[model samples]
Structure formats: C-alpha cells, structure tokens
Target: MGKYIQQTDMDAYRFYLASMEKSLATIEKYLRDINGFCSFAGGRTITKELVIAYKEKLIARYAVASVNSMLAAINGFLSFAGYGCCRVRQVRTQRRAYCHANTQLTKSEYLRLVDAAAKTGDERLNLILQSICATGMRVSELAFLTVDALWAGRAEVCLKGKTRTVLIPGKLQKRLKQYIKRHKIESGPIFVTANGKAVNRSNIWKAMKRLCAAANVEPGKVYPHNLRRLFARTFYHIKKDIAKLADVLGHSRIETTRIYIMETGEEHVRIVSKLGLVA
Candidate 1:
C-alpha cells in the first residue's frame, strides 16, 4: 500500500525524490508547482480534470510556450505523487510537427554579445556567458558546472538528459584560469551567489537580459540558447558537415541538426543555372 502525497507530505516528497534519484533543483520545482495546484484544488485531493482546468487557466494569462512547460512540470509531479498516467497526454500525437527554430544568433551578432559581456567587467558572468557562446552549452549545464568538468580541452555537459562534450578553445582555458584565481573560486560550482549557492538558470537568463540592455542589443537575440544555435551555425559554416554538428550537439537526429546549418547548401552557380535566367 502506497501513501498519498497530502498537502503536507514534505517528508514523503523528499523520500520520493530520493527514490526517483531526481536532482535537488528538479525536486524543488516539481514540489512547488504541484503543491500550488494541490493548494488551489482545496487541500490536495485533486483529479485530472482539475489539472487540465488549471492548465487552461494558465493558458489564458501566459504564452502557449510557457503553459506547455508548466504542464510538463505538473505532469512529472503527478507521476511521482503516484498519479501515474492520470495526467492525460497533452501532446496528442508523436506525428505532430514541432515549430521550426529560426531564432539563431548570427556569428556577427554573437561577437557583439560577447563583447558586451566583456565590457561589463563581471568576471564570472563574463566567463560564463563567453564560454557558453564558444561551446554552445545549455544554461542549466552551466549552472551545474564544476572545474573538474573541464578536461582534455573539452567541456562536458549532460544536456537534455544526454552527455555531450564540447571542445574548449585554448584562449578560454587561459582566461578561465585567470578568472578562477581572481574570484578565489577553488572548488564546487564555478557560478555561485555570494553565499556560495549554485547560480540558478533564471539568474543566468536575467543576467543575459541585463547584459543585453547594457550592450544596447535587442533582448530577443541575446537568449542563452541562442549561443547553442550560434555554435551549430559556426561549426556548420566551417565544416559543412551536418553529421559532425549533430555529434557535437549530442543530437541523435541528423535531420534536427540540419536545420541549424544556415547555408541552404545550394551551390550559388547551380541555383542560377536552374533558373535559366543565367543565360
């Protein structure tokens, strides 16, 4: 017989997280979100109908993108709380096409953002932002970073639940050493609050927004994920190999990586010849 997670199943929740082997941060987020829903549904006993209704309520005030993420988080909680398939599949089909990602920061735009971060003179912030742009790491990965994660001129990130290693530039390592010495960061996470807690992803996103404002760059183009896109764009331009880019980004699907290749790859002369206007 399994015990239900009531409004005050704090201990059970912690035990659940440990049993599932979820990260502390992930466990916190799910508890907060699920508890909110539980509170809203009158002291914890809730149904799938209530979950769907709350999702709808959220959709009215927030963007579809955000609502989808919230739903996913809640669904995870439901599963852990022993609801198990109680939350209906929000995404009806695997065949449904996902929106294409066209919001990529070009190479020049990427340079401008890096220059902006540098001009601010926030050593740790500068290193973190610049390194992500150079290596195309996810912001969450940056939050979880330790000095030991850097090895053999590569920075490894277990992104989207997959481990991928990024090649580190020589200049980056030298700067990292200098920054480490100046910050007196000898161990644990590289990015932390003054109290030494890990810097969360929201903090990094907010910092990027603040940096964009300081640099007079449009905020939209300066998103953290854009650095990953920039990395894919830069690599494809240099190597012209989608397979190689896919491997680096740790993408199992080559088709998904192909979209990151900026150059449509149609040779200029051949495109003109096909039009017959070349004659």
Candidate 2:
C-alpha cells in the first residue's frame, strides 16, 4: 500500500463522502458494501482480481442490477483509493425498461382500487391513495407530503436528484382540503403511522398489494410506480400532448419522459398481429 493510502485510508474514504452528493443512506450503503468486499478479499490494495472475485460472488447471490450496483460502489471507492481499474470487463446484462406489462388500469379498475382504499376508512390512507392515483405522485413523495405543499396548489418534489413543482387541479385541491379538515392534520407529513412517524415506503407497497387483492386486480399490475406510469401513459393517450405530460411529471428532458410513454413489450406482438408482411 502507498504511504498516503495506508496512513489515511479512512480519511480518504471520508473525502470520497465529502466530494459526492449522495444521500446519507446511499453513502452508508456504498461504504458498508465496499468495506465488506475489502474484508472478504483480505487485501490492503483494491485490485482488479479482487473485484473480479467479488463480482462473481455477488452474481451468484443477487440479481444483475443489485450486483452491478454493488460493483459500482466498490469500483468508485477503489478509484478514489487510487488502486482500481479504469474498466473491469464492463459487466453486461439485458435490462428491461418496464418490469410489468402495461396493464394500464382501466378507469373502472382504478376506481376499484380507490374504493378498496376507501374501505380502510383511515381517512389519511384514503387521501394518500387517492392523491397518488389522481396526481401520479410517487409513494415516496406522498410519504413526505406536507399540508403546505398540498395547499400551495403544486407538487414540489425532489426525485432523481431533481426538484420541481407539479400543478394540481382545482378539484384535487378541493378534495384535499376536505380530507385535511376531516383528519385534523395541520403540519408535518400528510401520512403518518399511529406512532406519528411518517408512513414508510415498505408499508405503502404492502398497502398496494392488499388494495390490488381487494379490488380483484392483478397483483402483477399493482406496483407503486405503475400508478405514476399509468398516469403518464393514459394521459398521453387521451390528450396526445407529450410536452404537457412532461411538464406535469417535472421532467426536464421530454426524452426522459418518453420512456414512460412507450408501451409494454406486448406492443410488439400487437404490431406483429396487424402487419401481415412480418409473417
């Protein structure tokens, strides 16, 4: 090991943390995963061979994306340590843009989910679920939503490292007002557990699973992100305005929003069915 690294390795790691803009949780994960790999490899220097072995070990136990992410963390830390390869064989995998079929919840199915959430009669849960379906806000965004943000007539969200505001309709505004009044919630996050901590994302995901079952909808089609994607796809299909949809989603790049507009892989089948020349 070099004089600088061996004497101040942890400080070097601290510098890496200071130089980046990642969240605390992500920073913790990157540090922990890299430290774990280093311990397993039993090396003072981060070497290409060690990284290769780590990659193989991760692949055997985790999905490609998870493996890749851990590798990226290790690679970043190693590079900062000044002992890593420029490129480590460039792990490749066939990544899908959409994890589920474009079930595109029919209006009735959408209503059914809302009705199921309504049956919970928690009032806060009902409003949160309804707001997500109505506005296409991410569940994480809803988890930290504030009364001020709601009444401001806009969605000010920080997602994908970008912060922007999304406009709300007058009708949604009225409904939100009524819900807030009924729940007697004045400040802090809109959705909180009985313990008063903001509702976590895991619970919201579980709620979606339950709601899907209650509505008799396919569990496969009921992820939290699906509500947002369905909003984008259904909105574009109805309005045919890509720019407007992009603005509402607060995407700086219309191209970024286009990925959401693309239909499921099944669309290729639809094209094959209609195009006789393909046969």
Candidate 3:
C-alpha cells in the first residue's frame, strides 16, 4: 500500500545503521537482505502477507537459523524505513545443547592442522592458527596481531565499535617474535600478503581449507571461527569458569559464551551413562 522501499529509503537506512555504529558486516548483510526483498517484491504493493510469503520462500531454501538471520536483517531495514509493522516473526526452534559432530574440532585434530601447515613449510598459516586458537579472537581481529602487540604480550582488538584486550600466551609470544624476526617485519600486522596488506578472511579461509586433507580434519570444522571455539572449550575445561571465559572471548552475554563450550555428544553420552538409570 505504502510506497515500495525507495532508493532514498535505502540510503537513509544505511545512514541510520552507520549512526548506530553497526559493524560493516552487519550493515552489508542488512542492506543485501533488503535489496533481495525488493527484488522479490518487483514493485508490488508491500504488505504483511507479502512478507510472510517471502519468509515461506526462504524457509523452503535455508536452515532455520539462516532464515532467522535474513529475517532479522529484513526487520532492521523495515523498522528503519518506518514500516516497523512489516516485520515478520522469527522461526521458533529448540536451543541446541551441542554442536554437530561434523562441526566440532577436537584438540588433537587442531594440533594436526597446525602440523599440516608446518609440514608444508607454511609458517604464516601455522602461526595464524595458533594465534586464533590460543587467544580466542575473531578472524576479523587478526589485524590487531601486530609487531607492537607481540612485544607488549597482548593485543587491543577493537571490533563492532567495542574494544577488548586479548592476552598472548608466553609461548605463543615467543613463537610470534621468532616469526617477526624471520620475516624481517619491522612494525605492522604480523600476517600480511606479498603486498604487505593485512591478510583478509577469504585468503585465510582458503589456506586453512588446503590443510584439511593432510590434517585429517573435516572441511566444515577448519574455519577461523572454529579455532576460537577450540580455545573457549579448552579454557573452560581447565578453569571451569564460564564468566571469565566470556570476558576473554569478548562476549557481552554469557549465553553466547555457552555456545562455545558445549560438550561433545560423546562426552554427553558418557555423562548420561554415569546416571545408571537404564538396566
């Protein structure tokens, strides 16, 4: 009924997101989702029913979590465009206590991934894996791993308009120093391409994928974010402190941290076995 999402409306929504200090990734995704909905609507009058129809189309093609993310982007854009009532309800699903087996990266597998990189004489990749796993930092924070941070034995990572401190382990600091010396890196991000720019996520992702075969780890479990989860699980195993771990992982919500340290299904089965309820 009201005018379809106009170019001026989209431009205003982008400015609104920037005013709220939304992360670049979030802003891009929201705008992309809004554009996709616009394409689907094809100048038709926008309504709640049309939104519901688009949601159904999404459900047929994507997982519930993915659909919810797209819906969230749509809702954010709608509210920004002064059509808040056009927002659709998110799909309801039970919370998962454990991640899928295919997604979980065991400590042994992680070590093998490191070894695989080293075996191929890829020093940078090896250190990248160790840096992320040891510090529980997001891949985007990799840019903060600079020569100065190495000397300081900690990195001040600023992400999503919030800054957090990530401590470098003594052994890891030593290794990084060696890497800096070997590469003759004077003062900049430790990980850089031949052109000396900070290594981007896509390059790191593809490099990690190449190690999957030699590491004997599943391809799905080899991304940079999984390394952070590995660190969270290991820290919780040793200290059993969820609250402190949440701080170290830069999460404002402990519930979000809980997702990182969920036990494996095998471990859950072992715990259930201890109950001895079955004959």
> What local distance difference test score does each model get?
0.69, 0.72, 0.91
Query: What 10-residue stretch in candidate 1 is worst by lDDT?
Result: 92-101
| Model 1, span 108-203: residue lDDT tens | 666766777778776677777777778767677775456665435666666445677777788887888777678878876677888988887777
Candidate ranking under TM-score, highest first, comes to: 3, 2, 1
- In candidate 3, what are the lDDT values of residues 177-248, reduced to their tens digit? 999999899998999999999998889999999999999888988999999999999999999999999999
TM-score of 2: 0.74
TM-score per candidate: 0.65, 0.74, 0.93
Worst lDDT run of 10 residues, candidate 2, spans 1-10
- Superposed by TM-score, candidate 1 places the C-alpha of residue 147 at a distance from the truth, in angstroms, of 6.2
Error of 3 at 3 (Å): 1.8
In model 3, residue pairs whose N, Cα or C atoms come closer than 3 Å (at least 3 residues apart or on different chains), thus clashing, are: none
**Higher-lDDT candidate among 2 and 3?**
3
Candidate 3 has its poorest 10 consecutive residues by lDDT at 1-10
lDDT of 2 by residue, 1-279 (tens): 562235277557866686665655577888777777867766445556667877888889988878878878877766777766532654697646553364655567777878888886645656666677678786667754677877888767876567867666688778888877777889877777878788876777787788877788888777677778778888898999999999887778997788777766676567667878763
Winning model by lDDT: 3
Q: What TM-score number comes out for model 1?
A: 0.65
